[model samples]
Target: MGDVIRTVKVKLDVRRERCDDLHQTKDQFLHCANTTAEWAWRHPDEYCVTSKQKAETALYDRLRDETELTANLVQKGIRRAIEATKSGVARLKNGETTSQPHFDAWSVVYDKRSATFHRDHVSLSTVNGRIECPYVLPDDPEQTPIGEYLLNEDYEFRMSTLQYDRSSGEFYLHARMRRAEREEHEQSTTAFSDAEHRTVLGVDLNVDGSLAVTSTGAFIGNADEMNHRRREFEKTRGSMQQTGTRSAHLSIQSMDDREHRWMQNELHRASNQILEEARDHECTHIAFENLTDIRDRMPGVKRFHAWAFRRLYEYVEYKAEMLGIEIEQVSPAYTSQRCSKCGFTHEENGRSKHQFACQKCEYELNADYNASKNIARKLLKRLHSGQTSSSGGAPCQCALTSGTLNLNGEFIASVDSTAEGESTDKPTTSVVGN
Candidate 1:
């Protein structure tokens, strides 16, 4: 059976005394981790992949006598520290030593064998003692509680980490678990899963907003409003920096976390809306531009920072994976400058910010819409050329679609097409002429 790894967050409600005990244990854990790392850093003769297990065994035997900590945690800390040092050495050997690993956080790692879970509470092994804490689950009426879900036969318990969130003053437990892959496809829910019915949805992400245009529909986010809010926050940060007071500096420090959370919510909402559009359109394949080198192409745009785009893509990616959708990121070369109609590339084709007009062919359309079509075409070419994912499935049929998707989940269109059995004014593949 195929496996999927997922991380779940649980809120920890422990007694004040237990909290203090856990905090002190975290200190000890970090201290031991640093010590192990430093020892590995100083001793180059004792490191080898073949003897890593032996090294861990020796460290385990020696650490137990030195630190008054649990057995599993000590092993994990030492192994993790050594692995971290090895990674640093590799990076340095590659001629890049901008930063090294630091054991800055205070936390405890727990394996499944040492931890136990009940319906809504959990017991963790700490140096002071085993502390029991109840967790708060999200408001999902359709799903069972996390604890009960873990107890199911199909689910497997995995490693977990208990950490203290200083800002919230509450304990949080993050558990990494796995489960057997579900059969979301072949159940008559989506066209991508059905062999005969398939379509590709091309998504274009811009600093102003995002556009997901498919054969039957398109989704657009409220990027302008989101950008406005971000700029306002940036101005506030600028003012705070100007004061240069201790309080101002503290405010500046606190702004990052708050802004990050806000950006995350905004991006998540946008991605969810796009996925909903794809589902409605029955699109099986989703294509996005590989923006790895986008920084060099368009620099100094705060909204287009690599992390922002990465986070947005990650949200869509995980959601897509859960639904059996095939996704690929094509190289971004001239999606914006090239004309989708006559294959003409010119510097002046996209002189305007919102519209694209081919100087040679005189074909005009929305700039993002044109880019979306190009992205879809790129993937279609790859699909027909026998460049499928490792599973090596055949290509899916798709139509070139165009339109606008508003934040209110409303789709306004200049051109639209209907899914396989739906009634609409337009036919699929109307523009691609396939």
Candidate 2:
């Protein structure tokens, strides 16, 4: 069976103008309530109210004559207030801690001088194209007048409505504004097949401008462009900080925003490219370094490392999911320092940035390649040992053709060339961090 997926969204504080309109609507409702109460007192036999609904209907009729506010918005406000009250009651029944009951929507009332809305006690209902809130309205001289309140300025508008499918017994709310457009492409629902059918691709990212992939060895790419832009931004920000001028501050802010947008886009593109290449090669599983603990391990300059590590992981996961590729996280301990050919671990083994020569086994290789090989080996071991959740689930291995390798006896170097008889050149080796 396929897994169930759902998308949840929350929209917070909206415009204040909508809120003000709601408040004014409430004030008109109270004026109607006071008139009804006075009529009921003078003619008790003719205007007898048995239920709250009766009073609410009367209030709605009176309010409709006084204001131009739409009936839909007023009803929506009343329904929201009632829902809040119901939610509070449910929480108390579940033995949850809660505060005292407060009025979710204010009721409008009229006095000799002006109209006002009181938050204490109010009954709301929708009738005859108006919202009816029948309650005793407060008449204080110090209180702000309802006529001064602006529509959509003090109150925000929210819509909530339920739709039910009788055939499927499914019910859901079709509410909230469309803030962002949804992608048209349908997502894949197939679960990943067993271990034998999948090949895991491990990727190692570093700040020194390199990307190491387990299956294809190492490639060069980095946040160097982002770093350069950031440096330029910092200079502008420094000048702005010294000047304390409005124009300089605005310029600095604009530059910072531009830099962030560019960097984020670039990172997304690079991560997606790498994942697509792996999928094209028939690798269904992807592995990455678990960088959560890296900050504690390396203390100083923690903020920089945290940002880079999080951005890389987020991009990889998002791209992998979109491509229907499964991702795994492996411990990053000693992946760079250990020898790939032989199982030897030593701090001095990696003497330079680009070179790694194991002291115990005397095996030497490019630093990035060594790390890639280690990552791949670790993933394979985990899969074979049944330590992974998706292990032993399927048996669909990809068929790969063998290639010829040219060996350089001088440095014990080996290079694999394509099947099309294309010649492979050895890379110029340079020692870094000597």
State the displacement of the C-alpha of residue 197, model 1, in Å, after optimal TM-score superposition. 4.1
lDDT (10s digit) by residue, model 1, range 1-434: 35676666777888887887788778767766776766666434544232334445345435645666665566667767767877777766688763334587857777653467554678887777788898766676236535444435455556778878889898987776667466633432453345544566777777664433333335356656767777888899999899999999888778866776676677767677667756665667778889677777764446345666666676676567557677778876788898866779888998987778889978877777677767766776676566763223444444344332322223334333333221122322213211
What is the lDDT for 353 in model 1?
77
* Model 1, TM vs. native: 0.48
> Model 2 Cα RMSD, Å?
23.6
lDDT of 1: 0.64
Q: Residue 198's C-alpha lDDT in candidate 1?
A: 50
lDDT of 2 by residue, 1-434 (tens): 33222221211121343334444545544334344444333221442332333433344323433555333333233333334444544675688865423342244222211212222212222222322233222354133322122121232112333223436433222222222112211222233233236565667666554532333442534545555666777787897889988887788788767765665566655566557546644566667777767677633324654665565555565446447666667787888898765668888987787777889877766676567556655665676567764565343221111111111101111133343311121122211111
The 10 consecutive residues of candidate 2 with the worst lDDT sum are: 403-412
